[model samples]
Target: MINFSLFVATVLIWGTTWIAIAWQIGPIGIVLSVFYRFALAFVVFIIGLAALGRLSLPSQWRFVVLQALCLFSFNFLCFYKATSLMPSGLVSVIFSLATIFNAINARLIFGERVQSRTVLAGIIGALGLVLLFWHDVTVSLDLDVVQGIGWAALGTMFFSLGNMMSRKNTAHGVTPVIANAWGMGIGALVLLGVASLSGADFILPNTQSYILALLYLSVIGSVVGFSTYLIMVARLGSDKAAYATVLFPIVALALSTIYEGYEWYGTSFAGLGLTILGNLVMFSRIKPA
Candidate 1:
Protein backbone atom coordinates (compact mmCIF):
# COMPACT_ATOMS: atom_id res chain seq x y z
CA MET A 1 0.00 0.00 0.00
CA ILE A 2 2.83 2.40 0.83
CA ASN A 3 4.60 1.49 -2.34
CA PHE A 4 1.46 2.19 -4.33
CA SER A 5 1.15 5.63 -2.75
CA LEU A 6 4.78 6.44 -3.49
CA PHE A 7 4.33 5.29 -7.08
CA VAL A 8 1.33 7.55 -7.55
CA ALA A 9 3.02 10.56 -5.98
CA THR A 10 6.17 10.04 -7.99
CA VAL A 11 4.21 9.89 -11.22
CA LEU A 12 2.04 12.92 -10.52
CA ILE A 13 4.78 15.17 -9.20
CA TRP A 14 7.34 14.37 -11.87
CA GLY A 15 4.73 14.33 -14.63
CA THR A 16 3.78 17.93 -13.94
CA THR A 17 7.39 19.04 -13.57
CA TRP A 18 8.09 18.89 -17.29
CA ILE A 19 5.63 21.70 -17.93
CA ALA A 20 6.92 23.59 -14.92
CA ILE A 21 10.35 23.20 -16.50
CA ALA A 22 8.98 24.75 -19.65
CA TRP A 23 7.98 27.77 -17.59
CA GLN A 24 11.66 28.04 -16.62
CA ILE A 25 12.87 28.43 -20.22
CA GLY A 26 12.97 32.14 -20.96
CA PRO A 27 15.94 34.47 -20.25
CA ILE A 28 17.81 32.64 -17.49
CA GLY A 29 20.54 30.22 -18.46
CA ILE A 30 19.69 26.52 -18.06
CA VAL A 31 22.61 25.90 -15.71
CA LEU A 32 21.59 28.74 -13.43
CA SER A 33 17.98 27.60 -13.31
CA VAL A 34 19.10 24.10 -12.45
CA PHE A 35 21.38 25.49 -9.80
CA TYR A 36 18.54 27.49 -8.28
CA ARG A 37 16.25 24.48 -8.22
CA PHE A 38 18.75 22.19 -6.53
CA ALA A 39 20.08 24.92 -4.28
CA LEU A 40 16.61 25.59 -2.92
CA ALA A 41 15.95 21.90 -2.62
CA PHE A 42 19.25 21.44 -0.81
CA VAL A 43 18.33 24.04 1.81
CA VAL A 44 14.95 22.44 2.41
CA PHE A 45 16.51 19.01 2.71
CA ILE A 46 19.16 20.23 5.12
CA ILE A 47 16.64 21.88 7.45
CA GLY A 48 14.26 18.95 7.34
CA LEU A 49 16.96 16.40 8.04
CA ALA A 50 18.62 18.44 10.78
CA ALA A 51 15.27 18.95 12.46
CA LEU A 52 14.57 15.23 12.22
CA GLY A 53 18.06 14.32 13.50
CA ARG A 54 18.87 12.57 10.26
CA LEU A 55 21.47 14.95 8.86
CA SER A 56 24.63 12.93 9.46
CA LEU A 57 26.97 12.56 6.52
CA PRO A 58 27.28 9.22 4.84
CA SER A 59 30.58 7.28 5.09
CA GLN A 60 31.24 6.93 1.40
CA TRP A 61 31.90 10.33 -0.07
CA ARG A 62 32.71 8.67 -3.39
CA PHE A 63 29.24 7.18 -3.77
CA VAL A 64 27.66 10.45 -2.73
CA VAL A 65 29.74 12.29 -5.31
CA LEU A 66 28.74 9.77 -7.97
CA GLN A 67 25.09 10.21 -7.08
CA ALA A 68 25.45 13.98 -7.14
CA LEU A 69 27.02 13.93 -10.56
CA CYS A 70 24.56 11.52 -12.10
CA LEU A 71 21.30 12.61 -10.48
CA PHE A 72 21.45 16.17 -9.20
CA SER A 73 23.72 17.99 -11.63
CA PHE A 74 24.37 16.50 -15.04
CA ASN A 75 20.95 14.98 -15.66
CA PHE A 76 19.13 18.26 -15.05
CA LEU A 77 21.66 20.12 -17.15
CA CYS A 78 20.83 17.80 -20.02
CA PHE A 79 17.09 17.72 -19.34
CA TYR A 80 16.69 21.51 -19.04
CA LYS A 81 18.58 21.99 -22.29
CA ALA A 82 16.55 19.25 -23.88
CA THR A 83 13.29 20.94 -22.91
CA SER A 84 14.56 24.13 -24.47
CA LEU A 85 15.25 22.36 -27.75
CA MET A 86 12.19 20.10 -27.86
CA PRO A 87 8.69 19.79 -26.48
CA SER A 88 8.63 18.86 -22.80
CA GLY A 89 6.48 15.83 -23.63
CA LEU A 90 8.98 14.55 -26.11
CA VAL A 91 11.74 14.92 -23.57
CA SER A 92 9.62 13.00 -21.06
CA VAL A 93 9.06 10.22 -23.55
CA ILE A 94 12.77 9.91 -24.22
CA PHE A 95 13.48 10.00 -20.52
CA SER A 96 11.02 7.16 -19.99
CA LEU A 97 13.55 4.81 -21.49
CA ALA A 98 15.35 5.00 -18.17
CA THR A 99 13.64 1.77 -17.18
CA ILE A 100 15.59 -0.15 -19.76
CA PHE A 101 18.71 1.77 -18.94
CA ASN A 102 18.26 0.90 -15.27
CA ALA A 103 17.86 -2.75 -16.06
CA ILE A 104 21.01 -2.76 -18.09
CA ASN A 105 22.94 -0.77 -15.54
CA ALA A 106 21.72 -2.98 -12.71
CA ARG A 107 22.87 -6.03 -14.55
CA LEU A 108 26.30 -4.52 -15.11
CA ILE A 109 26.87 -2.81 -11.79
CA PHE A 110 24.94 -4.86 -9.24
CA GLY A 111 25.00 -8.22 -10.95
CA GLU A 112 21.21 -8.27 -10.93
CA ARG A 113 19.81 -10.67 -13.45
CA VAL A 114 17.92 -9.12 -16.33
CA GLN A 115 14.78 -10.94 -17.35
CA SER A 116 14.02 -11.83 -20.92
CA ARG A 117 10.83 -9.84 -20.58
CA THR A 118 12.94 -6.75 -19.91
CA VAL A 119 14.79 -7.24 -23.17
CA LEU A 120 11.53 -7.66 -25.03
CA ALA A 121 10.09 -4.55 -23.45
CA GLY A 122 13.17 -2.57 -24.45
CA ILE A 123 12.71 -3.61 -28.04
CA ILE A 124 9.05 -2.61 -28.01
CA GLY A 125 9.64 0.69 -26.27
CA ALA A 126 12.51 1.57 -28.57
CA LEU A 127 10.33 0.90 -31.57
CA GLY A 128 7.57 3.01 -30.12
CA LEU A 129 9.87 5.99 -29.51
CA VAL A 130 11.30 5.66 -32.98
CA LEU A 131 7.83 5.72 -34.49
CA LEU A 132 6.73 8.57 -32.30
CA PHE A 133 9.67 10.67 -33.40
CA TRP A 134 9.78 9.46 -36.98
CA HIS A 135 8.19 12.57 -38.41
CA ASP A 136 10.44 14.90 -36.50
CA VAL A 137 13.59 12.99 -37.38
CA THR A 138 12.77 12.51 -41.05
CA VAL A 139 11.25 15.87 -41.91
CA SER A 140 12.95 18.39 -39.67
CA LEU A 141 16.34 19.78 -40.54
CA ASP A 142 16.54 21.69 -37.27
CA LEU A 143 19.67 20.80 -35.31
CA ASP A 144 18.04 21.68 -32.00
CA VAL A 145 15.42 18.95 -32.28
CA VAL A 146 18.08 16.36 -32.96
CA GLN A 147 20.22 17.65 -30.13
CA GLY A 148 17.24 17.58 -27.78
CA ILE A 149 16.75 13.88 -28.43
CA GLY A 150 20.42 13.27 -27.78
CA TRP A 151 20.29 15.23 -24.53
CA ALA A 152 17.21 13.39 -23.31
CA ALA A 153 18.86 10.07 -24.04
CA LEU A 154 21.99 11.08 -22.16
CA GLY A 155 19.95 12.36 -19.24
CA THR A 156 18.01 9.15 -18.96
CA MET A 157 21.16 7.08 -19.04
CA PHE A 158 22.68 9.25 -16.32
CA PHE A 159 19.48 8.97 -14.31
CA SER A 160 19.75 5.21 -14.50
CA LEU A 161 23.35 5.42 -13.38
CA GLY A 162 22.26 7.51 -10.42
CA ASN A 163 19.78 4.83 -9.43
CA MET A 164 22.67 2.42 -9.17
CA MET A 165 24.43 4.79 -6.80
CA SER A 166 21.27 5.10 -4.73
CA ARG A 167 21.06 1.35 -4.53
CA LYS A 168 24.68 1.21 -3.49
CA ASN A 169 24.12 3.75 -0.74
CA THR A 170 21.08 1.86 0.47
CA ALA A 171 23.04 -1.36 0.56
CA HIS A 172 25.62 0.40 2.68
CA GLY A 173 22.86 1.49 5.09
CA VAL A 174 22.58 5.08 3.94
CA THR A 175 19.05 6.41 4.09
CA PRO A 176 17.61 8.12 1.05
CA VAL A 177 17.05 11.37 2.89
CA ILE A 178 20.65 11.57 4.03
CA ALA A 179 22.02 10.63 0.64
CA ASN A 180 19.76 13.20 -0.99
CA ALA A 181 20.59 15.88 1.56
CA TRP A 182 24.27 15.55 0.86
CA GLY A 183 23.84 14.82 -2.82
CA MET A 184 21.67 17.87 -3.49
CA GLY A 185 23.97 20.10 -1.44
CA ILE A 186 27.01 18.84 -3.27
CA GLY A 187 25.21 18.98 -6.60
CA ALA A 188 24.12 22.57 -5.99
CA LEU A 189 27.69 23.58 -5.27
CA VAL A 190 28.85 21.86 -8.42
CA LEU A 191 26.26 23.70 -10.47
CA LEU A 192 27.24 26.99 -8.90
CA GLY A 193 30.85 26.36 -9.77
CA VAL A 194 29.98 25.48 -13.33
CA ALA A 195 27.80 28.56 -13.68
CA SER A 196 30.61 30.75 -12.40
CA LEU A 197 33.18 29.22 -14.71
CA SER A 198 30.86 29.46 -17.70
CA GLY A 199 30.01 33.07 -16.88
CA ALA A 200 26.26 32.43 -16.55
CA ASP A 201 24.18 35.03 -14.75
CA PHE A 202 23.57 34.29 -11.09
CA ILE A 203 20.61 36.62 -10.76
CA LEU A 204 17.12 35.18 -10.47
CA PRO A 205 14.55 35.85 -13.11
CA ASN A 206 12.19 38.78 -12.39
CA THR A 207 9.07 36.93 -13.54
CA GLN A 208 6.47 35.11 -11.50
CA SER A 209 6.52 32.07 -13.75
CA TYR A 210 10.22 31.44 -13.14
CA ILE A 211 9.83 31.91 -9.38
CA LEU A 212 6.83 29.61 -9.11
CA ALA A 213 8.37 27.01 -11.37
CA LEU A 214 11.63 27.09 -9.43
CA LEU A 215 9.70 26.57 -6.18
CA TYR A 216 7.73 23.73 -7.66
CA LEU A 217 10.82 22.17 -9.16
CA SER A 218 12.80 22.48 -5.94
CA VAL A 219 10.27 21.59 -3.26
CA ILE A 220 7.95 19.21 -5.05
CA GLY A 221 10.08 18.06 -7.94
CA SER A 222 13.55 17.75 -6.42
CA VAL A 223 13.09 17.33 -2.68
CA VAL A 224 9.85 15.40 -2.59
CA GLY A 225 10.29 13.75 -5.95
CA PHE A 226 13.85 12.53 -5.44
CA SER A 227 13.30 11.50 -1.84
CA THR A 228 10.14 9.54 -2.54
CA TYR A 229 11.42 8.02 -5.75
CA LEU A 230 14.76 6.92 -4.27
CA ILE A 231 13.01 5.49 -1.23
CA MET A 232 10.78 3.67 -3.68
CA VAL A 233 13.92 2.47 -5.43
CA ALA A 234 15.33 1.13 -2.17
CA ARG A 235 12.10 -0.69 -1.37
CA LEU A 236 10.85 -1.77 -4.77
CA GLY A 237 14.12 -1.85 -6.71
CA SER A 238 15.08 0.50 -9.52
CA ASP A 239 13.54 -1.49 -12.34
CA LYS A 240 10.12 -1.47 -10.68
CA ALA A 241 10.23 2.10 -9.39
CA ALA A 242 11.28 3.37 -12.80
CA TYR A 243 8.01 2.21 -14.31
CA ALA A 244 6.76 5.59 -13.13
CA THR A 245 8.60 7.05 -16.09
CA VAL A 246 6.41 5.15 -18.52
CA LEU A 247 3.20 6.62 -17.07
CA PHE A 248 4.39 10.10 -16.14
CA PRO A 249 5.07 11.00 -19.75
CA ILE A 250 1.38 10.48 -20.47
CA VAL A 251 0.63 13.20 -17.97
CA ALA A 252 3.35 15.39 -19.48
CA LEU A 253 1.99 14.87 -22.99
CA ALA A 254 -1.53 15.79 -21.88
CA LEU A 255 -0.25 19.02 -20.36
CA SER A 256 1.82 19.67 -23.46
CA THR A 257 -1.25 19.23 -25.58
CA ILE A 258 -3.17 21.77 -23.56
CA TYR A 259 -0.41 24.32 -22.91
CA GLU A 260 2.03 23.85 -25.74
CA GLY A 261 -0.61 23.03 -28.32
CA TYR A 262 1.06 19.74 -29.14
CA GLU A 263 -0.65 18.29 -32.18
CA TRP A 264 -0.88 14.55 -32.35
CA TYR A 265 -1.79 12.17 -35.13
CA GLY A 266 -2.83 8.53 -35.27
CA THR A 267 0.77 7.37 -35.41
CA SER A 268 1.64 9.18 -32.21
CA PHE A 269 -1.31 7.67 -30.36
CA ALA A 270 -0.40 4.21 -31.59
CA GLY A 271 3.17 4.73 -30.49
CA LEU A 272 1.98 5.71 -27.01
CA GLY A 273 -0.11 2.56 -26.83
CA LEU A 274 2.89 0.46 -27.76
CA THR A 275 5.05 2.08 -25.12
CA ILE A 276 2.44 1.45 -22.42
CA LEU A 277 2.12 -2.13 -23.54
CA GLY A 278 5.88 -2.47 -23.35
CA ASN A 279 5.78 -1.30 -19.77
CA LEU A 280 3.16 -3.91 -18.97
CA VAL A 281 5.33 -6.63 -20.41
CA MET A 282 8.36 -5.44 -18.50
CA PHE A 283 6.49 -5.50 -15.21
CA SER A 284 4.72 -8.80 -15.65
CA ARG A 285 5.44 -11.32 -12.91
CA ILE A 286 8.05 -13.94 -13.73
CA LYS A 287 8.75 -17.19 -11.93
CA PRO A 288 12.18 -17.84 -10.45
CA ALA A 289 14.69 -19.46 -12.73
Candidate 2:
Protein backbone atom coordinates (compact mmCIF):
# COMPACT_ATOMS: atom_id res chain seq x y z
CA MET A 1 0.00 0.00 0.00
CA ILE A 2 2.80 2.43 0.83
CA ASN A 3 4.61 1.63 -2.37
CA PHE A 4 1.42 2.11 -4.32
CA SER A 5 0.94 5.47 -2.64
CA LEU A 6 4.45 6.46 -3.64
CA PHE A 7 3.71 5.60 -7.25
CA VAL A 8 0.45 7.53 -7.27
CA ALA A 9 1.95 10.53 -5.46
CA THR A 10 4.88 10.70 -7.80
CA VAL A 11 2.56 10.61 -10.77
CA LEU A 12 0.19 13.25 -9.42
CA ILE A 13 2.91 15.66 -8.35
CA TRP A 14 5.01 15.45 -11.48
CA GLY A 15 2.00 15.30 -13.76
CA THR A 16 0.78 18.73 -12.74
CA THR A 17 4.27 20.18 -12.76
CA TRP A 18 3.85 20.80 -16.48
CA ILE A 19 1.81 23.89 -15.74
CA ALA A 20 4.22 25.15 -13.12
CA ILE A 21 7.04 24.59 -15.57
CA ALA A 22 5.12 26.55 -18.17
CA TRP A 23 4.74 29.45 -15.77
CA GLN A 24 8.48 29.30 -15.11
CA ILE A 25 9.62 29.25 -18.74
CA GLY A 26 9.77 32.90 -19.68
CA PRO A 27 10.64 34.71 -16.47
CA ILE A 28 14.03 33.21 -15.65
CA GLY A 29 16.76 31.66 -17.74
CA ILE A 30 16.32 27.94 -18.18
CA VAL A 31 19.59 27.23 -16.44
CA LEU A 32 18.79 29.53 -13.58
CA SER A 33 15.24 28.28 -13.30
CA VAL A 34 16.41 24.73 -12.91
CA PHE A 35 19.11 25.96 -10.56
CA TYR A 36 16.59 27.75 -8.41
CA ARG A 37 14.39 24.69 -8.35
CA PHE A 38 17.07 22.39 -6.94
CA ALA A 39 18.46 25.07 -4.72
CA LEU A 40 15.09 25.57 -3.12
CA ALA A 41 14.33 21.89 -2.98
CA PHE A 42 17.65 21.28 -1.28
CA VAL A 43 16.78 23.82 1.36
CA VAL A 44 13.44 22.14 1.97
CA PHE A 45 15.16 18.79 2.32
CA ILE A 46 17.57 20.28 4.78
CA ILE A 47 14.79 21.60 6.95
CA GLY A 48 12.67 18.47 6.83
CA LEU A 49 15.52 16.03 7.30
CA ALA A 50 16.98 18.13 10.05
CA ALA A 51 13.66 18.15 11.80
CA LEU A 52 13.62 14.39 11.49
CA GLY A 53 17.29 14.19 12.58
CA ARG A 54 18.57 12.55 9.38
CA LEU A 55 20.63 15.22 7.71
CA SER A 56 24.05 13.64 7.29
CA LEU A 57 25.87 13.39 3.96
CA PRO A 58 26.28 10.04 2.26
CA SER A 59 29.55 8.20 2.80
CA GLN A 60 30.04 7.70 -0.94
CA TRP A 61 29.74 10.89 -2.96
CA ARG A 62 31.00 9.99 -6.43
CA PHE A 63 28.04 7.96 -7.69
CA VAL A 64 25.68 10.39 -6.02
CA VAL A 65 27.36 13.15 -8.03
CA LEU A 66 26.66 11.25 -11.22
CA GLN A 67 23.05 10.85 -10.14
CA ALA A 68 22.83 14.59 -9.57
CA LEU A 69 24.12 15.39 -13.01
CA CYS A 70 21.80 13.01 -14.78
CA LEU A 71 18.66 13.20 -12.70
CA PHE A 72 18.75 16.72 -11.41
CA SER A 73 20.72 18.95 -13.77
CA PHE A 74 21.30 17.73 -17.27
CA ASN A 75 17.99 15.98 -17.85
CA PHE A 76 16.09 19.01 -16.60
CA LEU A 77 18.21 21.30 -18.79
CA CYS A 78 17.33 19.26 -21.84
CA PHE A 79 13.65 19.01 -20.86
CA TYR A 80 13.38 22.73 -20.21
CA LYS A 81 14.83 23.52 -23.60
CA ALA A 82 12.74 20.92 -25.39
CA THR A 83 9.47 22.63 -24.49
CA SER A 84 10.48 25.58 -26.62
CA LEU A 85 11.51 23.47 -29.56
CA MET A 86 8.62 20.97 -29.70
CA PRO A 87 5.09 20.30 -28.69
CA SER A 88 4.79 19.56 -25.00
CA GLY A 89 2.80 16.49 -25.97
CA LEU A 90 5.70 15.25 -28.03
CA VAL A 91 7.97 15.79 -25.06
CA SER A 92 5.59 13.76 -22.88
CA VAL A 93 5.58 11.02 -25.51
CA ILE A 94 9.36 11.04 -25.56
CA PHE A 95 9.43 10.82 -21.79
CA SER A 96 7.11 7.82 -21.92
CA LEU A 97 9.96 6.02 -23.67
CA ALA A 98 11.94 5.96 -20.43
CA THR A 99 10.71 2.47 -19.64
CA ILE A 100 12.58 1.16 -22.68
CA PHE A 101 15.63 3.28 -21.95
CA ASN A 102 15.73 2.10 -18.37
CA ALA A 103 15.31 -1.49 -19.44
CA ILE A 104 18.17 -1.30 -21.95
CA ASN A 105 20.45 0.60 -19.59
CA ALA A 106 19.63 -1.81 -16.79
CA ARG A 107 20.70 -4.75 -18.89
CA LEU A 108 23.87 -3.01 -20.02
CA ILE A 109 24.88 -1.68 -16.61
CA PHE A 110 23.42 -4.11 -14.11
CA GLY A 111 23.22 -7.29 -16.19
CA GLU A 112 19.54 -7.62 -15.46
CA ARG A 113 17.85 -9.42 -18.31
CA VAL A 114 14.86 -7.66 -19.77
CA GLN A 115 11.63 -9.51 -19.24
CA SER A 116 9.41 -10.19 -22.23
CA ARG A 117 6.38 -8.77 -20.45
CA THR A 118 8.18 -5.54 -19.69
CA VAL A 119 9.12 -5.14 -23.33
CA LEU A 120 5.55 -5.71 -24.44
CA ALA A 121 4.22 -3.30 -21.83
CA GLY A 122 6.72 -0.66 -22.89
CA ILE A 123 5.67 -0.98 -26.49
CA ILE A 124 2.02 -0.70 -25.53
CA GLY A 125 2.73 2.37 -23.41
CA ALA A 126 4.67 4.08 -26.18
CA LEU A 127 1.89 3.46 -28.66
CA GLY A 128 -0.62 4.75 -26.16
CA LEU A 129 1.34 7.98 -25.80
CA VAL A 130 1.46 8.42 -29.55
CA LEU A 131 -2.30 8.16 -29.72
CA LEU A 132 -2.98 10.20 -26.61
CA PHE A 133 -1.02 13.12 -28.00
CA TRP A 134 -1.83 12.53 -31.67
CA HIS A 135 -3.71 15.80 -31.94
CA ASP A 136 -0.84 17.90 -30.63
CA VAL A 137 2.02 15.84 -31.98
CA THR A 138 3.48 16.61 -35.37
CA VAL A 139 5.88 14.82 -37.70
CA SER A 140 7.40 17.99 -39.03
CA LEU A 141 11.02 17.51 -40.00
CA ASP A 142 11.70 21.16 -39.38
CA LEU A 143 14.73 22.17 -37.36
CA ASP A 144 12.93 23.04 -34.12
CA VAL A 145 10.82 19.92 -34.21
CA VAL A 146 13.85 17.73 -34.81
CA GLN A 147 15.81 19.51 -32.13
CA GLY A 148 12.96 19.11 -29.69
CA ILE A 149 12.86 15.39 -30.34
CA GLY A 150 16.59 15.20 -29.77
CA TRP A 151 16.42 17.15 -26.53
CA ALA A 152 13.43 15.26 -25.15
CA ALA A 153 14.90 11.90 -26.12
CA LEU A 154 18.24 12.74 -24.59
CA GLY A 155 16.58 13.99 -21.43
CA THR A 156 14.62 10.77 -21.09
CA MET A 157 17.80 8.76 -21.50
CA PHE A 158 19.50 10.86 -18.86
CA PHE A 159 16.61 10.18 -16.54
CA SER A 160 16.91 6.44 -17.20
CA LEU A 161 20.64 6.60 -16.54
CA GLY A 162 19.90 8.39 -13.30
CA ASN A 163 17.64 5.52 -12.33
CA MET A 164 20.56 3.16 -12.82
CA MET A 165 22.72 5.31 -10.58
CA SER A 166 20.02 5.34 -7.93
CA ARG A 167 19.80 1.56 -8.07
CA LYS A 168 23.54 1.34 -7.64
CA ASN A 169 23.48 3.69 -4.69
CA THR A 170 20.65 1.77 -3.10
CA ALA A 171 22.65 -1.42 -3.43
CA HIS A 172 25.47 0.38 -1.64
CA GLY A 173 23.08 1.06 1.29
CA VAL A 174 22.49 4.71 0.59
CA THR A 175 18.82 5.44 0.96
CA PRO A 176 17.13 7.53 -1.71
CA VAL A 177 16.34 10.25 0.84
CA ILE A 178 19.98 10.87 1.59
CA ALA A 179 21.13 10.41 -1.98
CA ASN A 180 18.56 12.82 -3.42
CA ALA A 181 19.11 15.47 -0.74
CA TRP A 182 22.80 15.60 -1.53
CA GLY A 183 22.04 15.24 -5.22
CA MET A 184 19.78 18.27 -5.31
CA GLY A 185 22.51 20.29 -3.62
CA ILE A 186 25.19 19.19 -6.04
CA GLY A 187 22.85 19.65 -8.97
CA ALA A 188 22.08 23.16 -7.78
CA LEU A 189 25.78 23.95 -7.58
CA VAL A 190 26.32 22.60 -11.07
CA LEU A 191 23.44 24.65 -12.41
CA LEU A 192 24.70 27.75 -10.64
CA GLY A 193 28.10 27.34 -12.24
CA VAL A 194 26.56 26.95 -15.66
CA ALA A 195 24.21 29.86 -15.19
CA SER A 196 26.99 32.11 -13.98
CA LEU A 197 29.17 31.11 -16.88
CA SER A 198 26.31 31.89 -19.23
CA GLY A 199 25.92 35.39 -17.70
CA ALA A 200 22.32 34.89 -16.62
CA ASP A 201 20.92 37.22 -14.00
CA PHE A 202 20.50 36.00 -10.44
CA ILE A 203 17.46 38.15 -9.75
CA LEU A 204 14.18 36.49 -8.79
CA PRO A 205 11.18 36.89 -10.98
CA ASN A 206 8.77 39.66 -9.91
CA THR A 207 5.74 37.90 -11.32
CA GLN A 208 3.35 36.38 -8.78
CA SER A 209 2.53 33.43 -10.96
CA TYR A 210 6.19 32.64 -11.48
CA ILE A 211 6.88 32.87 -7.77
CA LEU A 212 3.96 30.59 -6.98
CA ALA A 213 5.07 28.15 -9.63
CA LEU A 214 8.62 28.21 -8.32
CA LEU A 215 7.47 27.42 -4.80
CA TYR A 216 5.25 24.61 -6.05
CA LEU A 217 7.98 23.25 -8.28
CA SER A 218 10.56 23.46 -5.55
CA VAL A 219 8.70 22.40 -2.42
CA ILE A 220 6.10 20.04 -3.85
CA GLY A 221 7.28 18.99 -7.27
CA SER A 222 10.98 18.58 -6.57
CA VAL A 223 10.97 17.73 -2.90
CA VAL A 224 7.90 15.54 -2.64
CA GLY A 225 7.94 14.20 -6.16
CA PHE A 226 11.59 13.17 -6.31
CA SER A 227 11.47 11.80 -2.80
CA THR A 228 8.59 9.52 -3.68
CA TYR A 229 10.13 8.54 -7.00
CA LEU A 230 13.65 7.79 -5.76
CA ILE A 231 12.19 5.98 -2.78
CA MET A 232 10.43 3.74 -5.28
CA VAL A 233 13.66 3.32 -7.19
CA ALA A 234 15.26 2.10 -3.97
CA ARG A 235 12.36 -0.09 -2.85
CA LEU A 236 11.35 -1.35 -6.26
CA GLY A 237 13.74 -1.76 -9.16
CA SER A 238 14.18 1.36 -11.28
CA ASP A 239 12.52 -0.52 -14.10
CA LYS A 240 9.26 -0.51 -12.15
CA ALA A 241 9.84 2.90 -10.64
CA ALA A 242 10.20 4.29 -14.15
CA TYR A 243 6.76 3.12 -15.11
CA ALA A 244 5.52 6.35 -13.58
CA THR A 245 6.95 8.16 -16.58
CA VAL A 246 4.47 6.41 -18.79
CA LEU A 247 1.46 7.31 -16.64
CA PHE A 248 2.04 10.88 -15.49
CA PRO A 249 1.30 12.43 -18.85
CA ILE A 250 -2.13 10.95 -18.75
CA VAL A 251 -2.70 12.87 -15.55
CA ALA A 252 -1.35 15.96 -17.31
CA LEU A 253 -3.85 15.62 -20.12
CA ALA A 254 -6.65 15.01 -17.66
CA LEU A 255 -5.72 18.20 -15.86
CA SER A 256 -5.61 19.99 -19.20
CA THR A 257 -9.11 18.86 -19.97
CA ILE A 258 -10.39 20.19 -16.65
CA TYR A 259 -8.51 23.46 -16.33
CA GLU A 260 -7.42 24.38 -19.83
CA GLY A 261 -10.52 23.25 -21.71
CA TYR A 262 -8.52 20.70 -23.66
CA GLU A 263 -10.73 18.43 -25.71
CA TRP A 264 -10.38 14.68 -25.62
CA TYR A 265 -11.12 12.84 -28.82
CA GLY A 266 -12.14 9.19 -29.15
CA THR A 267 -8.54 8.33 -29.75
CA SER A 268 -7.69 9.90 -26.40
CA PHE A 269 -9.99 7.50 -24.56
CA ALA A 270 -8.57 4.59 -26.50
CA GLY A 271 -5.10 5.75 -25.65
CA LEU A 272 -5.94 6.11 -21.98
CA GLY A 273 -7.37 2.60 -21.88
CA LEU A 274 -4.35 1.23 -23.71
CA THR A 275 -2.03 2.96 -21.27
CA ILE A 276 -3.82 1.40 -18.31
CA LEU A 277 -3.68 -1.97 -19.98
CA GLY A 278 0.05 -1.52 -20.47
CA ASN A 279 0.41 -0.73 -16.79
CA LEU A 280 -1.46 -3.89 -15.90
CA VAL A 281 0.76 -5.92 -18.18
CA MET A 282 3.91 -4.35 -16.78
CA PHE A 283 3.03 -5.07 -13.18
CA SER A 284 1.20 -8.34 -13.51
CA ARG A 285 2.56 -11.17 -11.38
CA ILE A 286 1.32 -14.06 -13.50
CA LYS A 287 4.35 -16.16 -14.30
CA PRO A 288 5.18 -16.64 -17.96
CA ALA A 289 4.43 -20.12 -19.25
Count of clashing residue pairs in every prediction: 0, 0
Residue-wise C-alpha lDDT for candidate 1, range 63-97, written one tens digit per residue: 88899999999999999999999889989988888
Model 1 spans with C-alpha error above 4 angstroms: 286-289
* Residue range 1-289, candidate 2, lDDT tens digits: 9999999999889888876776688777899999999999999998999999999878798889999999999999998898766545446656766777887898999888878887888788767766765554553236776677688889989999999999888888888999999999999999999999999979998799989989999999988998999999888887788778767877766665665555677776777677667766866787743
> Per-residue error at 126 for model 1, in Å?
0.8
Candidate 1 pairs with clashing backbones: none
Alpha-carbon shift of residue 147 in model 2 (angstroms): 3.0
TM-score (C-alpha, index-matched) for candidate 2: 0.88
TM-score of each: 0.96, 0.88
Clashing pairs in 2: none
